[model samples]
Target chain A: MTSDITLILRFLSILGGGAMAGILGSLTGLGGATVLVPLLTLFYGIPIYFATGASLISTIATSAGSASGYTKHKIANIKIGVGLEIATTAGAIVGSLTIVAVHEAHASWIIYVLFGIVLLGSLIPTIQRSSSEEPLKRKPDWTTRIFQLAGEYYDTKLKKKISYEGVRWWLAEIIMFFAGVISGLLGIGSGALKVLGMDWAMNLPMKVTTTTSNFMIGITAATGSSIYWYEGYIQLFIAGATAIGVVIGAYIGSRLLLKITNKNIRWIFFSILSFLGVEMLLEGLDKAKVLVIATTIEEMISIAVAIIMISGLYLKTRRGERAVKAA
Target chain B: MNVPSKQRDIDSITSLILRVGVLSSLSLIIVGVILLFIRGSADGVSISQIASFHSTFNSSYLNPTHIVQGLIAVDPLYFITLGLWVLIFTPITVVFTSMVTFITAGNRLYIAMSLIVLFNLFFAMLAIPSLIHT
Candidate 1:
């Protein structure tokens, strides 16, 4: 009975967290983390480290969920995302290796600094007025110019042609380089940087900027995630729960977008996240002492179960490989 | 002379739809790039956004052996081999992956419900000069 209640509570927290993440994530263009991580840690009393691990799972979930919607709409720009991924993925590996090295030293200060930064960011609105008004000057780049990197988007509202030329590809590359480094080093995604890089240097439209930033995050996170797993930072049970929740949340949220006005959605969404962001900042500050939980038997079982699944996959792969050889 | 519609036609239509879908996604990426540039300096874009989330959660990820590292005596250097795959396929895979997602979740009912809310929001937001400017 006690276990049942814990499970129920767990389910509810994740569901609620996911719901909040979906609404606010779409609104703020900051993805779901703007609300999820804080909701888990501050409201539900999930630890920050654990919350972050869980956040990564949800982040991937939201990405996966949105990937389908964006694909249906034909707006994800997989080519550009893929091209930039080469740089980001490589950087993630190095970033993960760095985190593993730093784990031994035990840095809480870094989290504090990161929290301060997010607190500062959460308050600010996603400024877009100038984005529409300014006559964009495409910063010349050999790669962008040669490749005709500029692209166009239809304003659903304006119902007219809105086009932009590529800005400073070199600058974007450099920003991604650092973003990748941070992705691995902190076990945090590089969406913030990728969005910023493309925006400031490339001059993409706002929706396009937000979506592509979302597009580019998968590889970087996946790269860093692989490294983090080897070094033993992720707790599978927590991550699994979080991942499932976020995927569902993002799906529902995007679907809800169909009903909600984008402007109202953005306003309500940012307002909620901003509220949650402040709450998170306060909780993080109040709790100075850190508590590290031991990995549970449930997680061990989860890993064991996964191993069984992998062995099955391996046998299949071997049989396929052998058949090819025979052919 | 006009040809009759057939299963092949539906398949071809779907394929074209998929192509257009991917093209649209690519277009959004382009637009998104411009939005980011006009908003602020590139450094501010990603770093601050990332810091915003990281600061809130500050986590250490777990290292999984078999799943990530692939330790169970497969081919030699399996992880290295997988890393090679990541090197090649991450970007394009997301596109292909999106198509799969649409097929799995492509219900007109769900999509339509979601859009009613989405488009109205975007129309009002985009048309209003005040929100666009600030």
Candidate 2:
């Protein structure tokens, strides 16, 4: 009876945790896998490999959940997304193969450390450009002309149709390959990298970049997950539960996103990223025998720090608002 | 069809495909999970074991035929897995749709591009994985 109770609790918690991660993902535009993997491996004591597989499988759920909404809005550039997918899928195949080789060599530590670095690296650019809603236009290049990389979408906030064209298609494609490899390697959709490829390299509008990147993530993740599925990495119950939970969370979050302010939430997100990033790095080092400590204590300290940082930011923002009112 | 109207048609069709695929698969998964809860075991595997990190259940051995077979047995695990398979194939269907849409629209470049993308998806999902396993 006690064992059955524990089983029920474990099942529920995994689903709940996945739902929370999904909410964060919807609000922040980062793939839920980035948060979900860390939550499972670091908090729940699941092995990183299993956690990654679960996360990867759940990514497909969120991608499917959101892609239709974006498609209906006609904000996602199907042409660009489909075009870039050619490279992403190819890269994903190579990346999954590389991970298989890495697993065979027992180099799991490398993946942990690399995932940490990638998570940390993505935070800076997100912090820098979180408020910017558009990208500066650039002149069309040869690849743009050949690919016909142009799109138009209605900007609800601006109440006008915005026309945009993407340039430097080769650059976007090259970056997309790297993004795909990251997706497969880390079992994430790597939306940050995809956005950077289109928004920065191709000079597309931010809306198009985000929606198109979201559109592309489903296929990119599917490519990687097939290999992971074959390798026995995906935990069926956990993955299934997480997938269902995340879809619910994403649905709720999409509604909440409009009601909440985005600015201060970004700072909170950055804090969590930094905390998880450092924790994963330490975990990798611990596994590599470069560092040794009680894993539970380390995880507790990281969570505490993240909580303190978030509260600190909240206080600062409130104080600033009071000051403005006084003036 | 003119350029703008053609674009609208593609967008509408694509949106409908996405909605139908995602919604149907999600509902199937939810029902499967609820059924699993009532049954408490699937295909000789207990819920406690299946929920564990070290679950030994190898789904790779379960192909489409096996899934169909299990469905007749009313195995919730196979139903859940089938739902997942549908989710994976949803994007593939979208890409295939785009291929046909472009072909009919007389967009030569997009037709070629979509075909390549479709080929890549097929290669990654079926061809390469099977090759590696074999």
In CAPRI terms, model 2 is classed as medium
Across residues A154-178, which tens digit of lDDT does each residue of candidate 1 receive?
5555555566666676677787777
True contacts kept of 2: 0.56
- Global fold similarity of model 1 (TM-score): 0.59
Q: Best-fitting candidate, measured by TM-score? A: 2
Q: Would you list the C-alpha lDDT of every candidate in the order shown?
A: 0.48, 0.78
The alpha-carbon lDDT assigned to residue A138 of candidate 2 equals 73
Expressed as tens digits, the lDDT of each residue in B31-94 for candidate 1 is 3233332332222323233123233212122112332443243322232223222322333344
Residue lDDT tens for model 2, A128-177: 45344566667778887789887788877667788887898888889999
Report residue B106 deviation for candidate 2 (angstroms).
Answer: 1.6
- DockQ of every candidate: 0.03, 0.59
Question: Would you estimate the TM-scores of all the predictions?
Answer: 0.59, 0.90
